[model samples]
Target chain A: MRSPHPLRARPIVIGVAEACLRCVVCCAVETHFCHVQFEEGFDERYTYVYHCLSAPDPASNPGIWLCTACHKCEEACPYETSPLRFIEAAKAEAYKRGLAPRLLTGIIAQITSTGYLFPITPSTMRRRAELGLKPLTTEAAEELRQIALKTGLAEPRGEP
Target chain B: MRRYAFFPGCFIRVRLPHLEALSRRILGELGVKLVDVENFTCCPEAVSLSVDKMSWRVMAARNLSLAEELGLDILTLCNGCLYTLRTVNQELKGDEELRGRVNDALSIIDREFRGLIEVRHFAEILIENLEKLKAHVERPLEGLRIACHTGCHILSPPEIMGFDDPYDPVILDELVEALGAEAVDYDLKTLCCGWTLSTYGSREASERLLASKLNSMRRGGATAIAVICPQCFHQFDVGQASAARRLGVEYRLPVFYYLELLALAMGFSLDEVGYRYHRVRNREVERALEVAG
Candidate 1:
């Protein structure tokens, strides 16, 4: 998330084959959380996404959706290439191809639809009243719609 | 008085208003004024990148510009918001081309990415005024040993976040100790709360991860778990109940969103901070409440 690293972080741009195989033995995300904690049949192995990226289709690894983008991989990478860059890149491609997890896609769609991840209903307002706070309102649609269009996440809604 | 555009990230703003309430009351009492800006959306959380990295950065820039327009530094209560806002602000400010591209997108909405202001996590601001905070402590949590979970976004890729030492963090612990509570050392302190996995990947896996974290805290003799992130708060508090229902196990460790703990120490009673809303309650804090009654 520091400057310059994100642009330079693309897996193919930085050469993932070079980053993942030899240098990234310390796949901290996997080593730290994934080994046995993952659900059944989910590959509990480390660098699962790296291996998936090396394979023909990059985003095939279920692990891609699993990364919180916490950047543990960025810290662990010996080359400082940020294995996270590759995961995110692959995730974008996966999303573009309609391969991202449904739950995650629903979440993104929720944002694109209302700008808020969760519904800002009367209940939320009632709860806020109890706290002596305000109702949160945003013109998120038009703004997010424009970005979604530019980023290829959605089509124009025929608005001016 | 320290002034900030309080960007109470969506999870807290929408679902957990009590956390918002406590944050506002505590910061206000401490002489920090929180300004709520208009038209601010969700911080867009972890999916910011994979959903479409460009839009992620663009959305984050839009939020930062809202604060920049006001010429105030943005303060975040949740790590997810901090991750998106702070990281994107720093990245765009430092990169000409990136800022230009984001600005190009902003042009669509009649805005610009000027990067005129800064972004920060609330804890950073609080930690800076340690002596003032120490003096405000009216109810010292003498025997309440706490396991501090800073959550992953506030740490990691030290160059990016730059808030605390990622590997050996002492800021949150120092915060706890300053409030007169023990910051208990436990295993897997730096591990992700698996909130991401629970939401986007595997519930069973996150539960297992939660089990291990709870086991570690119990072993470390913790009385409560203090989290600065809402996601981690939900996972530890709500996730504990869900995990118990599914796994036939109960680890009823109370979860406090650091600000609540701060309020308690600052002489605001538990009820004032909405302790009743916490899915899990601290028995020790409750016992003290009954004694006071």
Candidate 2:
């Protein structure tokens, strides 16, 4: 599916991760936009993530793949720091460190290979026709293929 | 009537074309003409951010440039597409350095990032023309209780999306009520659908997130779920079946693209709105249509 831009997208703003979202109550993790938080009981992981962020490379924290990029924590943060930017930067940094999960690299590979997230099968095209929609084609697909090659996507470090 | 360069994102155009068909019909009814732009690509997708930010902007600008060339703003159906395209458009329009770099990358393809056009999400457009939209409601949905999932990308990081209130949204609810259906209030009303994680992260987490949302909707007395984004629709529709099998709870909540609901209100039958394509069918929706229509 879709992946984030960068854990820290330097283009948008470098050092986004530097703005530590130290919620006075560590509520971002507790109020995380997922069921997994409640399922695993994350009141304590808030402390763990706080300590984890204090580490040398906070992006190396395992399970960056799980962030939905919802940015609700950023909305709810009392510290007024953008927690979404921190998570995004951490995710990108993980990729640069080559520790990106298979999914990130795999999706880029799919896009570079097919100019789409999923390879459009004949059946998919037939389905569009069945719905009386236009064929899903774009001339810029060659451009996407070229840009992926020229820019050199972040290489995967190892299994996610 | 206004016109926009239509950017039907890959997910709906390929996987769920019914939404596209219904959206185009409904948008036309609301007095907007969607001009098809052939060269537009993936909103390169928001997730592409994790892999490469530079490429994400370049590709997004490439898609925007095609619409800009035609002198029309871009209209998108999916919120992810709105996120990628609108953010890139807003970023490129204000920043000269980033635009320079992205233009350099685009030079290879003979495309330039002029950043002239605005990117629009359908909810805002439909909401803007609510009066016209109201006139088209041939069959008012009285019995249906819709739990509206506005989805994140359509309204978040408010400065960029610039649509509804990111934290507490009511446009979908207003639209639902405009159609005479009850928009039920739920606890997880504005939570992420967790489809992104389910795709490449943790299926268990995604399924759990979905179940909680479904359970919340059920408690709110929701008979069906309404979504504006294709990803949310898939999660609520197909994800219901997956969560049911694993969690062993039949959260039989049928999902509708908000536009599909609009189409139904415009007196299109369930078959005409493609309800059969929904993964989890609810008799309440069908019964509401039969008894009320």
Candidate 3:
């Protein structure tokens, strides 16, 4: 059975030992990487809380990764380590192994294809118009296209 | 005596009309006419690219194309919009195949992107027109403690934006000095407010970032923090309270777009330029009005 999380489709690897330690302690998400297996006082309820920096269980089905490059951990750590970086590295590994979320992948594909977050269409104009917006024209459009073509960005919508 | 096409970006017209008012007031005093190039749209925001780079660039390129039509260099006040315009301009200018592809995309919008116009942040214009700026300072912002917050999008990947010293920039400070305010020097001036990421998630992280900035400003003896980006202004002004709550400290640092402060020094009024839009309530602006008066 496939893992339910999109990150599960990818292979999450911990390449750097330093990164691994930071992730275990600082990340808000409990990646379950702790040696206190027999400890009875650990609060599982508060494990995911932003304030609690305790290490989590690393064996019980590994753990969930949730670091969003906020740099809070980096600022808090006495060692000046960046847990956010490790989380990103793990996410990249997961993505490489096809474990990354399909939704994120779709968004990335759309961005790479359209050079925009939203689909550009007349509907966009209609929505803006509804909002009482005037979608003004860009006079430099042709010149910018020439620059893009010369630079090898994606081809503008219409050109021989 | 030089003129360029002005793209005020969206925030200037709505959230921070002071930027529009101040820039025009000061620049007009300096004998520079900023032409609002007709038929221009949003420089679009960088957030769109984080969602989709292709459509962002294509649409952004469309805006830049408008500037090229009139054969004028682009002068922008909003840093986010400037970055968006310049990023697309750099991408298309540097890559031939990509330019062709984007141009092809532009054909659909009925625009032909030739990519000749040079995109510049307003700071660059100050750097280029330093002497002229000094000449127009009726009351240079002297004795005022002004800290600068240069947003991340303004300076990064150093090689591309050769406009100013990314690591140790003094253009804004110097401009502030020229306007009669003492540009309060401080550390962490180059740090990002994490405005882009913070608005989405990282609320705690974002607050922490702003807290750090406030601490720096306080340490630097800043009466107020001056910014070029509307987002930076929003983060530093509006986000300061939330950040203070997170850090468990009281931080009442005032933040203003550099233009607003410049307008104040240039003898504009609180009501004339709309000082009410600021997130943080301020008295330094009023003080400047008194000083100028």
Each model's Cα RMSD? 4.9, 4.3, 9.7
Quote model 1's TM-score: 0.90
Docking class of 2: acceptable
Q: What TM-score against the true chain A does chain A of each candidate get?
A: 0.68, 0.65, 0.46
**Reference-based lDDT, residue B18, model 3:** 51
Per residue, candidate 1 scores C-alpha lDDT tens digits across B1-293 of 58999898889988999999888888998999989887787776666445577788888888888888888999889888888887888889899999998889888888898978888888998899999999999878777789998888888667878888776677999999998889998877877788877876667888888888888888998878999999999999999888878998877789888998888887777788788887776676578533433
lDDT of 3 by residue, B239-290 (tens): 8866776677876677777766666666666655556656566566567556
Model 3 clash tally? 83
Candidate 2 lDDT score at position A69 = 63
- iRMSD in angstroms, per model: 2.5, 2.5, 11.0
Q: Please give the DockQ score of every candidate, comma-separated.
A: 0.48, 0.46, 0.07
Where does candidate 1 chain B have its weakest 10-residue lDDT segment?
B284-293
Clashing pairs in 1: none
Q: What is the C-alpha lDDT of each candidate?
A: 0.77, 0.76, 0.59
Model 3 chain A: which ten-residue window has the lowest total lDDT? A30-39
Candidate 1 ranges with C-alpha deviation above 4 Å: A1-14, A22-25, A28-37, A41-55, A156-160, B288-293
lDDT of 2 at A39: 31
**Candidate 2 lDDT:** 0.76
How well does candidate 1 reproduce the true complex, by DockQ? 0.48
- In order of lDDT, best first, we have 1, 2, 3
